[model samples]
Target: MPSSSATATVTTNVFEAGKYTTVLQKVESRTTCCPANTSPPPPVPPPKPLLIVMPCEAGEFPLLVFLHGYLLYNSFYSQLLQHIASHGFIVIAPQLYLVAGQDSSDENKSVTATTNWLSEGLHHLLPPHVKPNLSKLGLAGHSRGGKTAFASALEKAATTLKFSALIGVDPVDGMDKGKQTTPPVLTYVPHSFDLDMAVMVIGSGLGELKKNPLFPPCAPNGVNHKDFFKECKGPASYFVVKDYGHLDMLDDDTEGIRGKSYILSVQEWEVQGADEEIYRRSCGCIYESILGR
Candidate 1:
């Protein structure tokens, strides 16, 4: 269970690297079954590996299952994952799929499977003396992965583990609300989300703008972060970061030319009862910037 206090001390800049030393590990799934000699043998399934980033110290830390964006590899967020883990948390990022269609139902199911697998297989992969506190588990993603996180939390896919916090970074549901993909989550209604956990929706002011004329905006107007936040209930907060886009949160080393263009910094902390203070501080900072004070 999370701390009941509503406030936490902030001694350092949240944007900088945390105090703990972190380590990264990659775990590949190994098949235990052998194919029988039959007339028609079934094809073997591909391995779904996991990229784990956690503190190297001996202590219990909260766990967060982070999903990668559309057609993006989990390793693309290596720096971001290490940043969170350095703050005394364990981040488990799974390579859900190498390629996916418009439909995201399968991705939702994959997240569920990965979450359930933690209880049985995660301990074996972790470093000695490092413990994961499953009770404080959180679910978060970027872009399409954000939508999958929300869909999975809304019961679109069943899982035994309970997520205590939910976060969406520039999440988009297709081009608009009218053209939502499979297993749609947004209802286009204010405070309509049935999520029982604390929610945070981070938007990008530049995301709705097209980089060029040939393609649509990465995060469109009607089905973007604005829509996701408007439909959240209490214990929720929304932040719109100016001069950034949907892909800005990814690590600088992410593959492709666009990866070198921009970088966005974000800090991960426990989301039990400190959301209100964080929201208040964020609003104050925005106000000060606007007033030039």
Candidate 2:
């Protein structure tokens, strides 16, 4: 029922915001508690609330469960999530944890719980007349969160809701090669992941380079985006923004010293104009390849 011109417009504008007005909402989980008189407390659910962004208009849209980076708050990605939502998708980003060590096993479990809660709790939280199409559901994350996304899709955690697409934005496994973190997802083998879903890996050209002598590169070599893309099988796409860093996709007003530094770097790239074009082209390619625009 769609016309060719409308499809063409979508194909050409993949890098820009779409034609929908979006709304953002933070939903807290409904927790139940037992009487304090009980001898021992029953197991409580993980307190992983969601930050949902979706179209304000009445329409059915695909859903993407986005996970935050290591120790990063879900609110930091407000701009990026809203951009995707404007493109007619509902993005649910969960605060997996307040603090975490090298182990991601618990984070993986939290993701599973959030995905399962979608069917029962999501509709109630969405805007009136707006619906989510679980069949076209996607899972995406940035930095260490990207590693978590891949692990969850590989069934490292028991997930009842199947994900149709997976995205990793400069995912990092550990400090360096052969030094992978606990429950490592990369096998160091070509096309080793058996995700059985469309995959997209977005890398940053500067991620493997050290920002200073004091700290290691945010996304170190051998365990970063390049390694992730190498192991992905067919029905996959890879994009690397040559002028960006691991945290450049975040909101411009992202707080903290690291955020300020990255914001300046982004400004430099924008001033050049050419770097921004390359970034846009890379993102547009991703939409065409994975979303079939």
**lDDT tens digits, residues 1-43, model 1?**
1111111223344444556677777665444223375232114
Candidate 2 residue-wise lDDT at 161: 80
Each prediction's RMSD over C-alphas, in Å, is 10.2, 7.1
In order, candidate lDDTs are 0.70, 0.75
Q: What is the lDDT of residue 120 in candidate 2?
A: 68
TM-scores, all candidates, are 0.78, 0.82
**Predicted candidate 2 versus true structure: per-residue lDDT over 87-135, tens digit per residue:** 7778889989877899999988889988987876677666569988878
Top TM-score prediction, candidate number: 2
Clashes of each: 0, 0
